[model samples]
Target chain A: MAEFKKADSMLEWFDQRLGVVNFVKVMMTEYWIPKNINFLWAMGVLLTVLFTFLVVSGIFLLMYYKPDVNMAFDSVNYTIMQEVAYGWLFRHIHAVGASVVFLVIYIHMFTGIYYGSYKKGREMIWVSGMLLFMLFSAEGFSGYMLPWGQMSYWAAYVITEIFGGIPVIGDELVVWIRGNFYVSDSTLTRFFMLHVLLIPLAIIGAIVFHFYALRFPHVNNEEGEFFDFDEEAKKYLAGNKKESKVVPFWPVFLSKDFFVLGFFMLFFFYLVFFHYNFAMDPVNFDKADGLKTPAHIYPEWYFLWSYEVLRGFFFEIAGVSGKDLGLMAFGFANAIFLVLPWLDRSPMVKPANQRPYFKYWFWFLMADLIVLTVYGKLPPTGANAWVGFASSMTFLALFIALPFITKAEAKKVGGK
Target chain B: MKEFKILAVIAALVGITYYGIEPYAHHIMHPEVAPADFSFKTLKNVDTTLAGNAENGKVLVEANCIACHAIDKAGYPAIMPNADAAASYGVVPPDLSSSGRIYDKNYLANFIFDPVSAMHLEGKYTPESGKQFPMPAYNWMSPQEIMDIVAYLQSVTPKVTEGKETNKATFEAACGRCHDMKYAGIQATTPKDNLKAYMGATPPDLSQYIKSRGEHYLHSFVNDPQVLLHGTSMPRVGLTEKAQEEVIAYMEEIGDSKKAERESLGIWVMLYTFVFAILAYLWKRKIWSEVH
Candidate 1:
């Protein structure tokens, strides 16, 4: 009877530790994420954090911000000068952080493209990412005018004027977007709403779908193979195939991600604490005087290439004068980037495994980017000026040629 | 499996919510969030005529002048890089309190019309014995308007005394802590970045700031100046446009006095490139981590 009582106490002790045992069992059995995921895998996690930062900061800015031209400039200055402590810091970090985010996103997308991450059933993942990119691009362009500085006003003026080149209803479309004869208070307000509210809400919804689709299959690599399970062992024991090498979702991968996040935080903090000065250009500080023209009024750095591309096609291609044609070409170039995923139809998953024609086209695209950037920096004069103009046309040709070239390369390599 | 699915959902929700708070806190700290309401309507009401119209412009002259120019001596207050009489008289405001004794209506109008032409258009000052320096012209106004100003100046009798000089000294002594080394009444055209690059700590001159900027911008600036101009270490000076136009006229009356130091664009380009390259490298590193 004493021995029986001892056994009962042992059972109680075992019961006390059931929660820990069950947790381990569930993790071992159900979770199939790979243990060998490399740094490339970190991008997915980093992107999640980045998207969150943009949304949260953007919403707060929208709270006090006015979209009207009369109020927009003052509103931004007010936000910086008198709003709240660290409000300026938040804005600067978010503004600069956005540029950083895109810089990271573009590289991540390219890396995914090069490594064959979108193959077979993984097409949805790429498509979702593309949708997210388009949403982000729209969001960036729309929010740019929120500051309502001379740059924002003129940039919107220059960019929106591009729709006038689209033939037939182009003029009407431009007017519709402007909400008046010009890009006025109404247009700014609408853009503010779209940027701060609509686009972000859509992006968040799409992110969930993107992650859901991403979960169905682990990422593919250059080899293009899947884990195979033994048929006999599966027939009696279980039907599931050899899945991803099992591991805990925390501590291992999470620790490495934390390290990368720490590094970025350090850089971001340094910029905020030491260099907290606003990007209000001297020309912008003069109160959007329509009469006085600033000697130079370039777009923010991120949009320089597109601006240069538009300027390239200004006179020669469309016979249009002034900044109109340049603006059109900029719009067209970016539109092509939005639709890139559907354009490339090479059967091989990896960039390295692509046909020679596709490979050559890719390098040409890279060269076009370099040319556009160089052209953006030059003064609009002399032989070098014309060369800058020519660079945009070259980039336009390369952009248009990409779809046809990829199709041809696929035909030569494999019909699919 | 169902319980584990529930757990994952809960975990993701909590993680995302916590992460979202970081940037939310970051955006609340901007400096320009609130602005004082400044109206153009209110500024038009301040009557600039000194001492209720009976003093006949003498009070206006006394209230405004006596800061820098002296009547007896040909010039006043000689400083380095501007030690000569030409520098003092040509650049500084002229003593118009005794104008009744020398010049006529036509002379004053012509002086107002083309002050540079009236004084031979020589620059801020001339070292030559009889060459004499010219004042900047106010071409925006008509001849009749210039005559009215001349008549107003001639009507005033000079009230030279110990008390007036002491009052002027007190005003300057108080304001001089900030305004002593101002741009000799000229409008500042220096870019903020270029200004920082050149003069290590000298504040910009606003001597002719009003005439150049005009009514609309000047009104906006005076309402809450720093909002329009970022990081203005200078405090606001209390003056209505009507009250300060003569001072503005006087500053323009002595134009082209100083030349700003120029900056090298090459150095700017180098700095921009270095920053761009560093940003690109960091982004590439982020991408590389995702690739492997």
Candidate 2:
């Protein structure tokens, strides 16, 4: 047998009761990862590191955070940032982590799609990861309300008001979610609970699910080549290391992860200290005023693309109201991501690099999302409105065109 | 190199979004106000070339200012207490100790000549039926005497810290009479209704004005409120160039208290992270070499 770690008596005693050594073998030492995967694969682990940063910093912020409408703004702005020692550091870490985590997530999501990691039997991995993202987004929206600032209050108000657009029980559902006619103390307190306790627990569960799902299908290689892991792992254990296409997950894989993580920390903390203001909206510095609405309101940049999709249907088409059409389109945009594995019908294993049309589609989709995000921030007036309409249409059109393009590619390859 | 290409794209996108687009969007949304004038050029001129002796200025301050304004650092208390003064004039006349440094010298000289026109409160502070301002125009006083009073005020003032504290005191001197900074525990010296009676409405509580209005907006608005919000009751406070900077610094401090700490710690954290990343790269190379 190939020895992973030489065990002593103390380890042996624990190993007998807990199956500690075997557990490590199954999870890490014996778990084989393809060697060809590049640093793009490391985005998943970077997200985990960022999540840990958020949780640790969030716990510190929780110590001083007061959820009451009267006290919430001051508690965050004064009690934590000014009064408590080193509190600013923790707040910075949490605030910056919230925004920076999204960058890694988009990278991970795109990397999966790019290499067709979401294809074959790996759909569960992508789905579970997407679940975590939705949960994280929920967490962000809820946590934003706890600050009780002008933007936080107004953003919560605008977002919850969207639920009232649902067909039948829409207005009642809005009342149920907010627990009032408008966003009030009940809404704030409930969101505080979700942000802190409930959603975080869901995220943790989703993280475990995501990781476990990846175990069966294995991490997809850069070129989407699937060789037998057992044979290559045996070769690695027998010391014909260069010939093996797999590496032990513990020492070999984790070392590389740590290197990526170290570089990520360089980027993350640079933002935490030097450029934290980007994460903190200046309008939110003022206390929440219920009577007066801010002149201009835009969601944070991460949500801007999706938000623009919701706003893009500017004209009435057929019988539907523009808002209802926009709302339906927005819903379509969000739900489309979940079905990506099924939508792509390519016989070609890797989606990019080899496939010419898919490569162009990927870049076009990326450029479209960026355009949507930019237009989302600008006022929807004159030509800016038309640009948003076209971009959002393109976002949907790309996905609708995906199956046709991939089917043609499959026929060209002369495969199922 | 591919990673660097990704990094460059990310940097470019963020740079475009934050530096380019955000400002451009703001400009489109908010009407562009004229830039602030610290020199008091908007006001009618007061020739500051007229030199005055400190000894002469001290006598003028005693005669003209001490009736309602206190020179506490100079051992002159107001003859009327603050409550009585507030009862008489809609707002209590501010103490004159720091006026030499905080208020523009030209503004001080001209304000003494005509209090009504100097503050741009011509309609409100005029000699109307029981609505006249308490501090009457000292237009009868000569220009030299007004400069002397300013010099005397400068002499008697306690030393204010150059940047932060001076700026804070300047904010208090210029803005505290009409505005409330609840975040900083500063309530307006003039009561809300009193200010409403005097200026048509109570000005906003300015606790987070630095954040809501932003630096550029605040600079222009504070220098001349009429420029941005035409017909605004808020008068141009006529602060000196240094005093204007001090006022902005004070607002920034209240709004972003951790700015100094964040800035100071940034370089060290960056250095540590860079070194750690370098070590990790070295370790990664070493570990990969064994596999090869």
Candidate 3:
């Protein structure tokens, strides 16, 4: 027994945390990760990885590109067609990565929302994630304008110029933004700085906060249960009375995460390496001309819903043009999205616990988003007026009505 | 095992965050100019004749008119009231979307070469109209390039609508930061009480000012306002002589509907930061629990 204890003592000395050498053991021993984590729980981790990929690849491309209306297009082309080896792949990855990051974040957020991940102890994570999303969108917009392509210039012109429809100071603000009359070198440089440095810093800080807050409360399972660790199981492993119910990281959670990570990595590699040619071509392959507007000036696909909303308002509305109304509605929609976590303060975190009314909202919100996507891609004809009206209503319903619905449902579920 | 899972997740997150930060930083570090579709070869579809290629025309405009006449929907220049909107001698910059609608090629050519003819400084649009455009002449623009500009403007269309308020508020918010006060409403010369009533921080009403001020004053004011009005708030509006003439000729549309929003977020940022800090402090100290 004494000899067995001596060997155990050596193993115990090796099982250290933080400063100790048995770091892996210590992590396996003390950390309290839930056993029944689902695929949704892995989304946050995946998004973090995707964000890193976007930043690393974006830096490599920026080294050679210029941000002037005159030279920005050529510089991007030169990098892709001439200078950088497989530069096209890098650009595609960065572009797709941006969309993917948004995609992942949206899923993660929905998961959080569906599960009541913002209640009580997890509020900080939800808030931090919201901040990250806002920064990400800004970064995406600023970067989208960099290629100085037709789409890039038009997107910048359309979005930036949207501010000109304001009650006053429209033109001056527009000029101030462009740093000249239109999207010139100054505008490109300014946007470049913003996209790369300022927004990224904010994203990094927000992510740090997100994880820091998450660490204290860990992952909330789908069943909406407070963590209950088995101390007797812990003590049995520790050779003391405090037995722990902890599962091994390698065979259980690690295996699941690794499998998912591998599948995503394979898809990403295929996307970057094989099927890479895409439509960021206007700027890289063509020169920007203010007079020659494209037949369709659509935003990147992820921004389609809001873009559709903006385009739909080109008709007469409450003493305003469709365009002005579109702009206002689009802004309002985005503003709501930024504040969603706070807006949804439900106590339920799982499908079973959710009230039927909230469940209906959840499913329909997805349908509305799909409708907006379709609306964004299509031209607004007289025939589409009803479609526009319906799309707008759906967006408002999802944005404004659902929060109250969720709150009411939460009250009923809690028997309050 | 649970501890190990946590550590693995943390490591994975750190690795990914590093990857995301760099390229995203790079892409944003220098905004790449947006790409343009150079379908100049396909201009046949649009049925617009450009003396130069549309791409070249855009570059030419950038070099010439973009300094003053904003072609992009976003960069519309500040329009002062012309004699039409002026009290006695008021002048406003007209929207140039239909410059082709308003002027023929010969008139545009002469206007580009000499502002006096177009402004009718020597006479009027017709003696019956009794109105004159105080357009400064452009000795700098070549007649061919002037024709090209005409061609470009002919291709342009106006998309302005009713709710798009082009008011004093909009002008000050959008164009005021750069142009300063070369235009009228932007000038600090207006009395505070009048300005507050007109629309706080309103752009000056330039209709009478432009008509009475004439081409020479408009030209010199835009070129170097310090020479005319000492310590003027207007920055040197960097425009070529041709652009100055076109802009002066076009300051015609000013109304309450066409205004911009003042996007000063300094106050909001300060306010939010204060709120967040308070929240953070309360959260850290557990003050909220004690209250509850």
Candidate 4:
């Protein structure tokens, strides 16, 4: 085994016994990272830190939370907020952390696309990330239900009701997901298990695989330059090179990541302490009532884009329900993002800044997302529905037409 | 110098965050004050020197209220069914079993003296024009007699054993005649048109009143409806101090049983969080020092 010097006597002893020093050096300290990567690159590290906060704070909240349907709201509003020590802080951190996590993940995903991080050898890492995101969505949806507030109950009902639109086993699946005919005690219990235990374990497993896949590839850079680490290392060992653009992850990337993490923490703590209920629906403070539905039932802002897609269709087409088709469209809107790497068939693996057309299309997609988010909160009326349908169609069109557009743009530019 | 800068920035941020959150935290810690219009002096001019007799008040309530209201779980057949009352008075009279838990003494006494004047209903509609509310002025009753009746109404506790009977009497006597009790399975038997004609709008269900309106607001409103709402038809029941206490108790018992527990535990929870936050900050600094 190759040996690396350990500075501390205690660490050296542990390294000899368990190879701890080598593992840390290889995975972190000695790891090569692109020097030019900007703050966007720090998102992955920030996300990991945020996840840790969520899991730790979540465990504390779980200590006081009762998942029973009748007791869920009281347990959160009364017992957790009022009975347990620092329960309000933990509960707020966990709840608000979920939103911040999504915010960070969205930026992280966008950064990956902007830098073509998902191309070639990084496909597996990207796919794993997508899988992690799906798990996150599931975890978030289930956690939202644990509060059992008016919005929680209705959101669960509306989202799960979409499954009932499927042909054949649709009705059964909805019933199965809910554990009954409605969002009841059984649903709350199962969702509690998913939110606190099952989904988190799955997320951790996915993250492990994600990092394992990420380790082999040199991290993507803003210049979209691919550095072959083996070749670079061979040259250095042979004395053909004294220095390289590739920098050690420890002092360079880690410092940047920590600085960004500190800034994020400052903002995160601000939200947790001050504006904890920012963007939170006021109606959710009321306890769940199955019979008394609020006039406007909307999902959390994060889920609004897909929710708007679901609302775009109101009329039945041919023999099928438009809503069922809308459900399919919503599923497709999310599922299409997973296959984005394949859809963009551009030969050049370059940053979006270098690809004008791709940049334009990416901005279009972002605009579509923002519009959908805004429209999702509005009542699905005549003009809004038409606008939603048009934008949703454009959203799909941009993705489907990506390969052709990229090919044509590449031909015109006369470059790979 | 770099370390100092970083530390100073963090300290500044911490200070800002603390200052930013102080006002909201203070608001949460303190009791909320109602708007000036909703506020009223409680039992100010009433002679509290005369102690109320619950037993005597009960007799007076039986004589005065039973004609229009029912205050028992056995569902005493009302003398005027909701429909007849609605037809005669425009709005059906409310039940009174839980009134003791809902109203304070001074407002109740003032209301009993002159229902129309107390409710500020004199200019809104007139009896000569057949647009007046049904509740008659009880100004003829002495302050002591009114206090006794208030004491009797307040003494009637809702039967919680059946769960549904928890607010049955107070609700029937004060609010049930017009408003529906969805949770308790009681429906208003008043004709829809009569309610519309009399009250301008059909009364909303009151099962969730205490949860929605809160105790302090209810006290002021029940004492004098017009003080909080300029033209509400709900007349003052003229309750005294003891009666008011009992009524407020019932409302609290039914609506917010966990309130005291919630409030008492909150300060300790905040304290624990403050300590935990300090520990978390130290741990975070320790871990991040590896990279720095």
Per-candidate iRMSD: 16.5, 2.2, 20.9, 9.8
Best by lDDT: 2
Tens digit of lDDT per residue, candidate 3, span B1-292?
A: 7636644754564344323333332243223432221221211211223363445445555666644443434355533323222322222233454454334445454555655433323432336756443344556655556666666665664433323243333333223333323224455333334334332234444432333344455656654454454544343333344444444553323210111111133334345545544544444334212212
Q: For every candidate, what share of the true interface contacts is present?
A: 0.00, 0.61, 0.00, 0.00
How high is each candidate's TM-score?
A: 0.55, 0.91, 0.53, 0.66
Residue B18, candidate 3: alpha-carbon lDDT: 29
In order of the candidates, what TM-score does chain B achieve? 0.24, 0.78, 0.29, 0.52
Task: Show model 3 residue runs off by greater than 4 Å.
Answer: A1-31, A166-170, A229-254, A276-284, A352-354, B1-292
Over A1-416, each residue of candidate 1 has an lDDT whose tens digit, in order, gives 22322335664556455555566544433333444444555666777777777767766676667777777765655554235454554565567667656655765676566555665677788878878877877787787777776667777786788788777988999999988878788888899888877988898898888877766665554344454322322331353223323333343345555555554555544544443222333334334544445545565545666777867654544466646676667667777755556666666555444556766766566556655654564455666467767777788787677678877877877754
What is the fnat of model 2 with respect to the true interface contacts? 0.61
Highest DockQ scorer: 2
Better of 1 and 3 by TM-score: 1
- Residue B274 alpha-carbon offset, candidate 4, angstroms: 17
Q: Ten consecutive residues with minimal summed lDDT in candidate 1 chain A?
A: A228-237
Weakest ten-residue segment in model 2 chain B by summed lDDT: B122-131
Q: Which of the CAPRI classes, incorrect, acceptable, medium or high, describes model 3?
A: incorrect
Q: What is the lDDT of residue A241 in candidate 2?
A: 77
Winner on TM-score (1 vs 2): 2
Model 1 misplaced regions, further than 4 Å: A1-37, A222-251, A274-283, A317-332, A338-342, A351-360, A396-416, B1-292
The digit string of per-residue lDDT tens for model 2 on B174-215 reads 999888887799988877777788777777777677876778
Is 1 or 3 the stronger prediction by lDDT? Answer: 3
Query: What lDDT is reached at residue B216 by model 4?
Result: 63
